[model samples]
Every structure is written in structure tokens, then in C-alpha cells.
Target chain A: MMTYKSEDIKKMNSIELLKNLYQLNNATMAELVAQTSFSQSSVRSILKSLENKGILTLQNVDQSSGGSCPGRYTFSKEHFQILSVFVDEGTVDLKLKDILDNTIFHKHIVCSLNEELENIIITITEKYVVNCISIASSGVIQDECFYTDHGEYMTKHEIALNLKKRTTIPIIIENDVNSMMMSIKAKQSCNNLAYIYMSETGIGSAYYVEGNIIKGHQSFSGELGLLPYQNQTINEVIASKSAKEVLEDMFVLILVAVAVTIDPEKIIIAMKKDNNLSLTKIKEGVSKSLSKRYLINLEKSTNPLEDGLDGLHYLGILKLFDLYTDYNREKRNG
Target chain B: MMTYKSEDIKKMNSIELLKNLYQLNNATMAELVAQTSFSQSSVRSILKSLENKGILTLQNVDQSSGGSCPGRYTFSKEHFQILSVFVDEGTVDLKLKDILDNTIFHKHIVCSLNEELENIIITITEKYVVNCISIASSGVIQDECFYTDHGEYMTKHEIALNLKKRTTIPIIIENDVNSMMMSIKAKQSCNNLAYIYMSETGIGSAYYVEGNIIKGHQSFSGELGLLPYQNQTINEVIASKSAKEVLEDMFVLILVAVAVTIDPEKIIIAMKKDNNLSLTKIKEGVSKSLSKRYLINLEKSTNPLEDGLDGLHYLGILKLFDLYTDYNREKRNG
Candidate 1:
């Protein structure tokens, strides 16, 4: 754990300045001074330090008169690379993206239950200079371990430990639904949102509150399938549904429950591309059951698999930056 | 909205220091300097400012040898009073508590459907010199206004606005379940908790994540009555059940749903004193339904009404302190 001290305040201020520069993309000394309350000398000193650390680059754009202008500071685009993977029941999709959002590699692999996960990860790492690895799967993850609700993979932590031994980079294993939620949160401006994921196997949910995903105490949040309804669980009803109206009714009940409890700004239903369901019908059915004041917007996800992969990539990049920040803090303290 | 500039940083540091002093109750200058990373001179400067503002008092503690010793700084208690009220369907319980947690007055009044809420509030305010008022009711609260789920009250906001005209103190209206949750959070150390408030009217829930309450987008995050279960909602099942076993079964299903979704560390069932159900049976029933990994501790609230009132008082005091901080900042800027 890190404790904030008076000395750390200056370091924190520098980090804030660097974050602003990252967000700004390119800024001159005068623009930076105008953007922050820090003195001009403080801004210059911090920028020079970042430049020395190879985190930022300074470039001078000359005017038509040929006179020297203040140099512009820009964050390094290719400072790190992240390997993100989304694992389904029988298939795995992998993508390696740079800090600048460039996709360098993409691959999909179909694997059997007995396949060696460690060897597959090692082979992928040998092909790229990855700084962090993030994998999304359908399960409960805690303390770098995975526990499946219905699966045969018993040595999940052993696989994670084996991967850790193969590389010095950090490994983040997250639930697939949580990954999709993060992806949606990254793209939307709403502070409170809920993502409902429906698949042939079961239905789950992920809540986004003020930029943070609510994973709950044991990482078992969003298990909507466990909800008992109509003398049976939601999963049983959905699985046994014979008519479209029955399915729509079940959805309406779920939506009404979500609206009345969470009252999110938007409810996103994430399904496979092949599962065609009209958002309009579902929204209309839910609206009739709820009061006007409690009506919420409902939409369908464009691409859930891609969103899950993107969420993994985003989380991996965040971990890489956190590592960088911690390394710098350690260097400063030393 | 507030932005953090260099000047605000100084003010934040002062607030942090003051909070530490408030938590510590009393400490010498050397002790304060040792506790924080700030310099001795900085500590002295902040303490002197607080002393001059009458927020803290300095006292000398002599050594055993009868010689002069260092002075101690203590936060002044009883600086303000909070008027807390819990409004039920037909009755209102009120209490006036000081900043030091002392209850100065308590009253219970029965109200009819057509009674003017502003007059009741005015009658209470006339009995005390209150700095703030906090009301906990069974409704959806937003923007300091109440909205009942099922009631005859048409203009809840108008009533609140009218009360504002009669009293100059700050007023806060909150959901009763949220208040109970807040009170429990204040007294416990659990980071993740869920409180299930069960009454004859309906069943509601409150989720506590980290140090903040999850109020959702519209402050309707815990209306469990809307959840569909077993050909009816949880509220419907509980309200219609006449046997203890039936109620236990319903509780088991609800607990399983909560466990699979939120996975809270502890689930506190807040029921009226007369509604006696065995905790062991409910725990056993839920554990049998869920896997061993999802087992959670279940407890009963000792006093729901007191907790609600205390929560109101606590929130009112917090708002008061926030107001003090903002006022000081404005003064400094002026």
C-alpha cells in the first residue's frame, strides 16, 4: 500500500501534469501554463523531466518567418503493448494492440478441453513484445484465480501461475461480462449504466458506477440467471421458451426489475450477432409494465465479442500505465 | 463542480489535517507532526488557524515533575445540532441530536393523510435551535425532494420547499432503507455490505460499496419489491405467506439471488421487532441452495428505526462539515 506524504504531493502534481499532457496530445509551454495553475518554470521542469524519461517528446514548429517557436510536448505513442484475449467455451480470440490503439496482430483459435493453456500463451508471447496480458472468460475471478459456475477447468490458478512464470508482465483475468461492461463504459458518457449479457448458456449483468465496475465482494455479481421467476429460474424459462412472446415477457420482467432497482440511465443487452432480437419490442414490453417515471432506455450491443476484447485491451493498457507510475514513484523515492 | 488547482490543494491538505485531528480527538503538536508528513511549522500553523476559528481548543498538560509541558489540541464537540425525522406511513419519529452524538429531544407524532408536513416540521423546529434537518421516508428521493411509491401525497417537493421557507437550515430527504444502510456502515468495518429491509409493506435493499452507498441513477437502486420471483415478486410472496417455512423459502431464494449477484460480505435483514424468523434456518436454507463458495454471513438489525434516525443525524453532520469547509474556502478566496 502507498501512503501520501508531503513529499509525494510534488510527485503527484507532476503525474497530474503528465496526465494532462497525455490527454492534450500536443501542447506548447505557453498553452500548458495557461491550462494549469502551476508556474511556467514548474511546467517546464516537469516537461523536461518527462522528456528525459522518454515518456514525452518535444518538437519545435517553425513559423513562416523562420523564427524559433516554443516547443510542443507530446506523449510517446508506442511506449507499450498489450495482449488481450477473450476466451469462450471452445474458442479464443487474441489481439495485440499498442498504446496508440494500433492493432499489430489478431488471431482466433479453437481449443479442446485438454489443451495446454500455458503452452498456447507462451507461443503467443514469443511472437510479440507484450508488456501486459489480459484474458476475459466466463467465470468468477478473484486474486488472480478463476472459478467457473459450470466447467471442468479445476486448475485455473495453476494456469495463471504458469503464465506468470513464463513472463515478467502482469496478467489480469476478468469475467467476460465485466469486460464487456468496461468496454461500454469506456465508450459512453453515462455514469450509471448496466449491461445485460444473454447467451445460450445463461444471462448475466454488469453495473457501471461512476467509471468503476461493480464486481461485488466475491466477483459473482451480474448472475441474472439465478433469479427465480415464474416458478423457475430465469435461465430455465429462457431455455425452455417456445414462443417469441414468452421470451419477450421474460425480458420485460427482467427489465422491470432492473429499472426499479438499479434505475440505470441505459440498459444494454449484449448478445451474439446471430441471436436476432428486436430492442424495440423488448423496450415497449418493459415500458408497459413500468410507470412513466421509471421508464429507461434499452438498446442492443453492436458486437459483444469485440467489446469484450476491447475491454481486455483497455484494462491491460491501464495496468501498464499504473506500472509505469509505480516505477517512477519508486525511482523518485530511491 | 470543483477543480483542483494548486490553491485548492492547500485547502484540501488543511481539510485532511483537520479530519485527522477530529478523528484523533486530542493530540500534542509534536504528535500531530509525527502522525502526518507535514513539517512541524506547518502543523502549528494549521492548528493555530483552527484554534482561532474556535474549531479546536488548546490545553496544557503538565508533566509528572510539575514543570510545564506541551499543549494539546482537541476538536470542539457539540458545535451544532441536527433535527432527524423518520416518516413512516402514519407516524413520524423525531430526534434532535448534537454533534457529539447526544440526543437532546425525542418525539413521536401520528400524522393523517391530509396533514400538512410543513406544519409538523415547523412545530418540531420551534423546539430546538437546529443547524440542519434530515428526513428519512419510504420513497424515491432526488434533489432534496421525496416521491412516494404508493401514497396520496401529490406535491412532496412543494412540502419540502414550504418547510425551507419556515426554517433557514439545510434540509435533506433520504430513503429510509438507504439511511439504515448508512447507519450500519458507520458502525461496521465491512467494505462490501447489503442491507435487506423487510416490512409488511414491501422489501427493499441497500448496497454499500467501499465507503459510498450505491443509490443508482434515480435513487431507486434497492427496490426489491420489483424483483420477479416464483410466479410473483418477492414482496408478493412474503406478503401472502402465512407459514414460517414459506417465508424462509422466499428468504432463501432472495438471499441466493443477492449472493449470486452482489456477493456481499454480510447481508443484514432489517425487520420489525415483532417479525421473528430464525436466522439459522434462513442461513441453512440459503447455503443449501448456493455453492460453498457463495456462503455469506446473515445477521439481523438490532434496531432499524434508531439506525435510520442515527444515519440521518450522521449525514446531516457530514453536510454541515462540508458546508463549513466550503465557507472557509470562499472566505479565503474573498
Candidate 2:
């Protein structure tokens, strides 16, 4: 199924170079050549074309290495802006970021799903020329919609339909756990990885195998909270009682479930910082059940909110590239 | 990490064509051109070169559809012969397969692992020009060595080393569950798949995500038997008593674990043909816990042995290509 030839590389050379360049802080023609394994002329022409189109900017760094060439190139960060909306049970946080991931605006509100989301987008779009919207929610998200949990008053809600009607920009709606996993993977670089996130919105888990997220045959592939425990679901056990009380057994069981199934290298546990869940205690409990023969890094997320946003921002960049970057044709800027 | 370009296509073209051609029965030049996006001339020249090298045979059939063209080209199945060895606790089965996957010879012996394997290879090599050896065992297999279950007299065995001393051929040692999953996947074609195989060798599982197998952070990724149950490992529970006694609750818990983790579309259950484990009972048990909101196909393997051999054969074919097929360089015959 993975059949391919070199002509594919020749076709996708410019896109690959641009994408690789975007990943770096700044790159030289020599660096680009090494990074892409393309000829120096190919990198030179592509960068020149991108600079002419205002997609990239040439920074005149005083480096004697490039005696006869232009200075380093920086991907024009402000070329495309992203509005990342993170919605949970009782809170909504929005950050307007440039293509370079520089936050231009930030706001938070106490609401579930209402006109407030549309208002936030309007507020952000009014200030900055946003190119895409990335919506990361606590519950399962399908297409441009979000599906909340059972027993919730508002079960389903449209994510960015109002904004869609007003703007021709692209939008992405994704499950919080999956997006969280993506960003954490960017940091951890764990090919086979699992993610567990817990907060006021409750707990959710995601599985990443190789380079792809195992969305399963279903949308809710990582609904760990729905797993059965002692006469109650995992969510019920945590919801009714202090999570600390049943944390050991719950954590160990989750370890077993994930470790036996996907066997990820790192299982990132993202929790609300104020939840008072001790990492040492959790590790001690897990170590008692699992031996050191197999090294599964069970660690806490440094900052759930920031990491989730990172993932959302990366998704936004990908969405923007999908919408605008067509190397086969003329460059279309929104 | 997945940044790639199309020139990769130009380099890997003929190899891709040969690899793809091996998967099919026979294809006309038109079909080959369509299969590969390459122009008709590119396909024609490649096929002609392959036909000249005796790697492919041009067949002539009485059909007006081809017009002036040769009927079809079948990959020369006799290009390479592979020795597939299946090792279990009680018995070991060996089959000699051609590149086209035809069984050239077959033999079964009542043993786990010993010098008998090397002797059999020596026997096969004296008659047939064997090019590769694929060893599929019940327990964990790493590198060219096979690690058997605990309490077994022979825990570690060097697989086909004595024969390797005689012939410079490719040899692969893989876990049986993984091989079983590969072949079942070829039939089922489930993108996200989990395989549970129950035979005299005991219960084991393998996970497949996207197009890659989740071999875990460790080599023994699919050691499902080691999972904790009621006061005993899942393997110990099944080993100590009749699997039928603990089948329902055991199956239910497994379903809950796998469903909550990597919610594969299909969970293939391969059991011993003689064991009277009813699918109805297993399905009823699983459905009691899991709701109808999501669908997961839990079916039995029609023939575990045949499916596993198919996977091994496919692996053998890939190994042959890796060792012999070089589109950029002159053809090497061993």
C-alpha cells in the first residue's frame, strides 16, 4: 500500500521545503538544501518565489557565511493568523495567534455553548486578520460540531457555523484529548503514545500509533471515562468522590489497559494543576503493579492549557496550509 | 518527521512496480499503466526489462481486447522459495513456499525448538533453492532469536542459525500473533485492528494502527496474557482452568479494555478449531457492557494457520525484494 516513486518527491519539493522552513526559526539556502536534500538551485528558487509572494521575509542577518547570497528567511508569521478556541464544561479560552505561534490576543469566559463563542470569534476577527479557527473542546467533536457528554443540558452544539457564514476562512473542530496528544507528541516525540487528560470537564484519553492517531472505527476512540470499574463507570468513581481517594487503583488499571493494548513509550497525563493529584503517589502506586522490565513513562503534563493550545495552533497551521498552499498552482492568499 | 517530496518516487519507481506487481495475479500493460500513474512507455520499458531478466513471464491468451499487445505478465513465482516455520508449545509446522505463495513442500513435527529446525532447512535447501526463512512462534521473538514462555525447558533458541552458516539468505523471526493479525487484516482490511488468538500455544494479541503494527516501546507489545485479572494474570487464569469456565467475564473485561483504549473496528478472535468457544456467547457477553451507539466487529478467524502462513509468505516476498530487487542498480542473482 505504501508504493511510491521519486517523481512524487519532484512534484512535492516546493511544498516540502516550505513546510520544513515553517518548522524552523530561520533557515539559510545551505540549511534548506541539507534539510530537504534538494539541489541548492531548487531551494534558492523556491525561497525567492515565496519571498516575491510575501509568504516569507528575508532577514539580513550579518553572517559572513553567505557572502554572495541573501540573508536568512523567516516564514512571514503575520501572513496568516489563527483563532484557537478551547471550550470545556464551564470555561472557554480563546487565543489569537500568528502563523509563527505568537499570541496577539487572549480572552477567557465562563460559559458552555452559546452566542459567546461567536462573539469571541467576532471580537478576535475584528482585531486581527484571522486565517483559520481551531476549536478544541472537552467532549467528542465531529466535523464542525461538538457533542457533549450524557446528562448534559445541551447535548449538541454547532462549533463555528455563524463565523463560517461571515468568513471564507477555514475552521477545524477536534476532540480535546486528541489535540492534546498531538501537541504533547510534538514535545515528547513518542511514536506509540497514549494521553490521559482530566479537569473540571472530566477525564478523557487518546491513543497515537506511529504517526497517526488511532481514532478507532469510531469517533470516541479514547473515551476512557466510560470504562467500567467497581459497579460504576470510571467517570462516576471520580465524579462522586475525591479523585485522590481512588486515584491509585484507577491509575494502575489505566496503565494496564493502555500498556497491554498499545504499549506506548510515554503516556502523558494532563490534569488540572490545582487538582492536588500527586505524581509521586501515582507513580508509586503504578510501580507496585508494574515492574521496571518495561519502561512506560507515566508523567504529568507541564501545563495542560498551554500544551492543548500548542496542539490547536499546529492544527491551525496544517489547516491553513491545506486551504492556501497549492504548490501545483498559483499561490492563493486569504 | 513525515516531511517528504516526490523525487522519492523517481528513485523508488521500478522497485514499487515490482513490489506491486508481485501482489497481483497477472496484469496487462494498460492495467499496469493505470495501477501506476506512470506513462504507458515507462510501464512498457520496465516490464520489458523485467521479462528480459526472467523475473516476469509474458503470457499470451486468445483475447481480441489486447489487440497487438501481449496478453498479460505474471510475476515469476519461482524467483524465490521461502521456508515458513511455525513453532508452538507442542508442535512445529514447516512449509516451503514459492514467491507466488505456492506450497512446494510441507512437514509437521512434535517439538518446540531444537536442531530439528536446522536439519529441516538443510533438507529443504538440498532440493529447493530456498531464499528466505520466516519463523513465527507463540512467545516473544526478537532479532533472529525466539524467546519461549516461562517454565519451558528450552526458553531461548537460536532460530535457523545453523542453516544461516550454510546459506547467505534473509531470515525473520516474528511473534505468531503479529503474523496472524497481518493475514487476517489482509482479509478484513480494518485500518485499526486488534487480534486475539487462542490456540494450544495460549492466548495472545497484536494491535495494528493505520498501516503499522503497534510493537510498543518494547518488543513484546501484544502480551495480552500478562494482563491482570481476578488475583491472577490473564494467562494464569486461562492456564489453570478450562478457558470455557472464565470465558464470559474474561471476554467481557477484555472487550471493555480494548474498546476503551484502541477502539478498533474489528477485533479478530482466532481460537483453536477443536475448542467449542461459541461466538454467540462471546458476542452476548461483550454487548451486555458495550452499547449499540458504536459498532465493533468481533469475529473468529476462518483458518488461523492459513492466514498466518499468508502473512509469513508476504513477509518473505518483501524480504526477497529487499535483498534482490534494485531498480537503480544492476540486478543481482543469488
Q: Which candidate wins on TM-score?
A: 2
Q: TM-scores across all candidates? A: 0.82, 0.87
Tell me the tens digit of each residue's lDDT in model 2 across B208-291.
877777777765466666666776667776777655748657777777778878788788888767466677776776665665
B57-145 per-residue lDDT for model 1 (tens digits):
78886365367588888756545688888887788888898766678888888862233656776877786678888888887776667
Clashes of 2: 16
Off by over 4 Å in 1: A1-52, A57-75, A111-127, A149-154, A236-246, A326-331, B6-52, B58-74, B111-129, B150-154, B163-168, B235-243, B326-331
Q: How many Å off is the CA of A205 in candidate 1?
A: 2.8
lDDT of 2 by residue, A1-334 (tens): 3445443443356566766777666888888888778778778877887788787889878467657655788878876788888776678888888876677988778876677667767767777888888888876666667777564243777756766887677888888788887787655546778888876535788877877877777664777776667767677777876557586677777777777787888888887765666666766655555554556577788578777777888788766655444543442222
Query: What is candidate 1's TM-score for chain B alone?
Result: 0.84
How many clashes show up per model? 0, 16
**How many clashing residue pairs, candidate 1?**
0
Chain A only: list TM-scores of all candidates. Answer: 0.83, 0.85
User: Candidate 1, after superposition: displacement of residue B216 in Å?
Assistant: 1.4
Q: Show the lowest summed lDDT stretch of 10 residues, model 1 chain B.
A: B1-10
